[model samples]
Target: MSEQVFLLPDLGEGLTEAEIVEWRVAVGDTVTVDQSVVEVETAKAVVDVPCPYAGRVVALHGAAGEVRPVGQPLITVAPLDAASSPAGGEPAGHAVYREEERAGSGNVLIGYGTGHGGAGRRRRRPRLAGVDDSTRTAPLPAPTGAGATSAATDPPAVAPSSPGPAALSSPGPAAPARAGDGAALVISPIVRRLAREHGVDLATLAGTGPGGVIRRADVEAALGTAPAPDTARGLSAVPDPSPDNGTALPGAQPQDPTGGDVIVPLTGIRKAIADKLSRSRREIPEVTIWVDVDATGLLETRAAINAARPDQPVGLLALLARICLSGLRRFPQLNARVDTEGQRIVQSAGVHLGIAAQTDRGLVVPVLRDAQRLTTTELAAELAATTAAARAGTLAPARLTGGTFTLNNYGVFGVDGSTPIINHPEAALLGVGRIVDKPWVVDGQLAVRKVTQLSLTFDHRVCDGGVAGGFLRHVADCVEQPALLIATV
Candidate 1:
């Protein structure tokens, strides 16, 4: 059998593993070259993985929710004319399968090649042994309409020869499949964890997702969290309270005297946040400095700008972001990354501002590319659109990364000040606290004014406190006297 195997391709941005989100094609189904066979979520974004070979699907390597590292067998497909190919067949390894992943983007992955053909080009993917073939059922042929399975119907499932849920590893250090724990058809690890925490039996609940895979809402519904998800307070709240960039999610507790212990395993974005933050703390010698500023001028300028363009009113974040760009222009040292291993400081040529936003998935810093070149209105529009995309989970992997500096507005959460950790490798992070009415000395008299606290966390390796303090003072001056930014124009 000229069976070919496709591996989970590299997700780039140095990500090593991706959790299988869904299996689009099953065993015995036919797939064309570049056809999306599975959906996988990396630390960066959720992406549909396309198969590189065209043929009959002989096997699927892992079930949804399983995290597979780069270069593992994803699917095995027989030759286009291999009509006699057997279903649920063992992967034929390098003798047949090549692990090239054509993930939509024609751009070839790091270690993977674009298989243009020829048997000599076949690359071998690591195969897992002792795969639970119980889930490997041959697809039942549809009875009518060109033998097609309609969209409303259940996706092709393996015949009774299998009660499914493919395993990631036989007994490796990988997370054990929930099926082994007597769970069924649950594709989301978060849902599984929620069920386990609430003592809810998965077997008794009906799933509402594609192919009967359990969803987070289904589990939440079982737990009576029904108050319209949009209004519910849990993971969806914005203005992340955690000390900037990467930190633990809010509402996490090590111990609860009344509830024994509620432990949420770090997964998905949470895991990414933890990894990035841990790296930042371990390698970077960081320092923090904060200043309280009279933001009345900045806010008044925003109001006047909005009054002129009522249809496109600017936000406080937008004003603060513009001021940040100005400050970075004056002190380019803060807009940089540390090449610790190379023992070098790398300042960015252009400002790719990372906006820290709290999304339903978690806190993601979506970068505004070439931010230094944008007008205040363009910057505001881009920031708003990028943040919306992040929350809506439509942002591409590239948009979520490659930030030179970060702007975190913890003020959205109504906090006064925070000592935020810098995003990993990045030299500095600028945070803004809430703008509130407070007593201020204006014209040498104590008067009520809009005040806000600005905090900056910078890598000591990048610049001394003198530079950091100067950059921060510049930002404060811009806030106190909005005309300072106009002077540059």
Candidate 2:
């Protein structure tokens, strides 16, 4: 039979490689055009790699947890009619393979060209035994806390892979383990790592997931009550082992040094973040400056807005974002970036504001396109939606890049101030600290006022302190006197 090998396609955002989280199609299983045959986790997102040819899978290239580079063969499929010869008298394998390629639906992964709509399916084509069309194209499960009814579906297309049978339906309790087989039906690396940390034997517990698969929640359940923050940080109560003379003391922690400490490899999004941050620090000469502002006026304005329109209350962050936009307009230098290779400070004409958001996956900055043009109400809505998408691990790669300037509200973390590292390629970042009641002199009288600190970190090469200070002062002025926003608002 003619075998056609499919290479891993670029999943966008210039990602060069992906880890094989799970194989959707096993050897000998027939797959149709545009049907998802493998699930891969790129640096940016976990995506399903669709099969371009309608054929039976003859070979699988990589195992779960193995990273594969772009342009490498992912799977090899033999067209169903490979044995039949064409009327042109070409080799049967070659002729059949050519026909299969011609019949391909030309559908690719997300953000790439896909012939099918969001349906992720095409018209019915020939199939083989052990292939169920319904389960192969099921939508990924919703993010936790979405309030959507949890349906038994494939784990997720944008999360760390969770492997199982093709169907999401439960197969009842798993049968008793056979000899020499002790690993449970667990797919998540986090779950496995956590279980190992807690010394929980997977072979001994009954999983609560579909088909008795072990889940993160199930492992936590077996550890009795949920783990407290500190305990959750590590399996044991011992703190991080202190180093002595630049060396780790033997037997000072949970794992013995003789056995070697865990060496977690940096991959996927974590690696990408590391590379960018390291480059920023190595290349950019940065300086930080901060100022404390009396935020009583901003608080009052926000409260009044909420009272006027409780249905669409504006968030404090949205107000601060508006202030940043105005500050950028006055001192555009802070909104520019140093194009080192190009040897120029490329100042963007419009503000592509980025909001630093923490998510289950990692820290991500989702950019709001043309943020300067949006009203406060529109800004609030976009902020809410972008932050939600970030937390849900569903923000598109495009939304996570191309930010000219960043607004970081570390206030949510209840911190007072931070000299945050600049997001790479961006010249500056504005950080807002928590607002709290503090004694302040107002109208020549001491009284409790809502006070917040604002810090700015900028690339020294992009602009001087005078420019940075002016931009920050403008923002602080807007915070202290909300009326200052009138001209720009």
Candidate 3:
């Protein structure tokens, strides 16, 4: 088999590098074309890197927790038919291997990713068995929650070289042991990441998901933070006692050399956030404007809608999103971004609304593509689904970028107000504060009402205070009277 080197393809969005999270196949292990061989954590998301060549793995280029640049050698494979040829040597069985490569993978990376579409068939292409038995498996089991699903659809692709043993020698009730045996029933890489951060052992903890799949909740429960209905027994309430294991956050520097402080290496999501925020601050001359709004009508409208369709109740954020959409329609200046290189203000034809969600990894803003086309209900559903994906750490890299406008609901953390840094390139951000009971004048009379503080941080380069105030006032008007949305519709 001719040895083919697989370089880490450019994981889009102009990303230049990624941190190696784990490797599914070790040296000597066989892999099929499109089979995920590694999981890499980029600035935006955790993604599975598929093998383009179907062959026996001869070399792994990097270890977990290391950063690899784009176009660098990731893995090396000896094509199944090229047994006599070694790397850098003339191919003995080159014709057979090259033919298979051309037919199977088209001589390169498969569209930069096979993550969401998923790899075709994980089953090995049989040679010893002397048959092509690799067939697509049955459907994935029912989803328990956002990150909780079967291994078929979104396999976590746990690495064989876990810090601890893969599984217990003695099995428990949830599923079979995995050490030196089979793969772990983990569907989300975030769950695997969470376990590593908290030093939770997947082999020991019984999963509560479909067919005993370990979900993020299982790891959280094991960490003594998130509650679980049927968490595994015989698990430690705290992180394990490994010297440099999950107990510490990922990317944390090993014990301080000078005993001064534990320095956390800013790499994955944290680095992305820092760079974006710094660029936004340095480039944009920004301004913050806030207003108090009576949200009684918005709350009532939501209640009436929920009463009408309890099965698909609209969320407050969705309603706010609807309001933002309307406000932007009236004052489209807020729905824009600044092009420094081009020296112009670019207004988007459609609103790609970004919703900020805080997960175990950090803050992530998942964008809704062409949100102008979605109704409030559709907006709610999209928000819910993307929020789940964000929480699961499975959000596509595409979903994390290209936002024309941002809606930050920091009220979930009970904050009254914040002048949030604008998502870089995006001209504006609308922050919604906690809804609380406050006294307000209704028809010149004092009354207690559901009131919320709204904060708008926008680029001075995009619009002046007049345009910013007009947008915020329009949103407040919609909050005070949901019927205003009719005109928008």
Candidate 4:
């Protein structure tokens, strides 16, 4: 028998290490090629690392909750069919899965070579051995409409065949699934982890998602900790302190035993944000410019367009994005990045605009590709879809990268203005504040009009205050008289 070791491949986005969240397989279990054997949490997102070899698992390198560096041993498997081996192979029973031999899932992590339609393509999940076929049932067909399975219903059992919870190698505290209950129809590893943490029975809860898939909300609700309404939009509140108990609530850190201060560990998405913001502050020399504009015309223009379409209404952010595109056309310098290593400016030809969004996973900026080419309606649709994916934590890593400039609508936080930090490597960021009724001098008379603050924070290395001021002024002009867009649109 040939024992092949599977090394932990790079999880991409320059991440050096990952915390092993859970192991889906255990020693002595049979696994297929491209099967997800381990789940790891990186700085940005949680990812599933698929095994490249097909064989019986012999050894696991790391325990759950431990951090493993890239290129280290993750698992060892003994090939089921070894008699067909070549005459000359690696030294006695210590073989590594060669690059040519791997047939990986097409969802390739960066730096890892991608595989074609070999064992990588989607296929039916293999059933576990020793599990009776009668107990193993096919997954239930998804309900066609919402609330199809009412609260009165016991929620039908549509379990598929899996290795069961005992097969999972989790040293961390996690509730195991009951024996003979059948595998829960769960797709997300995060949801499973949350359910285990709270000791909630996955077999009991009815899935509200498509195809009877269980979502995080159902688990949270089962735990009796109602998620915030903003959670749907991807914004969640951070915990501070409790008056009576002196202990923080869930998602909050506990106070130190010394009775001095609370110690919150910096990790995951929060740490990533901290590192990027610090680097941006240390390396780039950024300048901020602001202007309070009369948005009366912008609001009226939106109302008129929505009235005409009625069904497909344009959002204010989309109109603002349209204006930003026009201004970038006039001042293309803003649509660029500074290359410190090459000691030169790297100007891009097209605008890949990044919209700053606050998600449950912290601040994530989803990029809209070829922003300059898309119409206002198209831009609106892209913005909505990207934001929704961000909230759902389903956005791909590629969508989070390759941004030329960023547009931050911090008005959702009810703030009037903010001198925001520029997304690293990007040349500029535009901030839009809340629009409110304020006194304005219009047509030589005092009038109450909708006014909002627009701030531009830009890299001085790419453009001086003159260019930055010009871009901000053009945006303000468009806000005051949206008809100015007709010239370019």
Best by TM-score: 3
Output the better candidate (1/4) by lDDT: 4
Give Cα distance to truth, residue 470, candidate 4, Å.
1.0
lDDT of 2 by residue, 1-489 (tens): 478898888777787898775555567556656656666666665565677776767787877667889889888988776454346433222211111111111223543325555452342221111112332333322322211211112212122222223332233333432212443555334454455545555555565654355566676676764333233223252122111001111211233224545443476677777998999999989999999999999988988998999888688888988999999999888888888788899999999999887644567788999998999988888888777656445556677799999988877666899999999899999998878899999889999999999999999998888999999999999999999899866
The residue pairs that clash in candidate 3, if any, are 1-82, 1-83, 196-246, 197-246, 199-246
What is candidate 3's lDDT per residue for 357-447, written digit by digit as tens?
A: 7766778888998998998899988888778667666666878899999998877666789998999999999998888999999999999
Error of 3 at 42 (Å): 1.0
lDDT of 1 by residue, 262-290 (tens): 44446667789999999899998999999
- Candidate 2 residue pairs in backbone clash: none
* Model 4 CA deviation exceeding 4 Å by range: 81-107, 110-115, 118-162, 165-184, 190-204, 208-212, 215-263
Instruction: Evaluate all candidate structures by whole-model CA lDDT and list the values in order.
Output: 0.65, 0.65, 0.68, 0.67
Worst 10 residues of 4 by lDDT: 240-249
TM-score of each: 0.67, 0.69, 0.74, 0.72
Q: Cα lDDT for residue 373, model 1?
A: 91
TM-score of 3: 0.74
Error of model 2, residue 333, in angstroms = 1.1
Q: What value of lDDT does candidate 3 attain over all alpha carbons?
A: 0.68
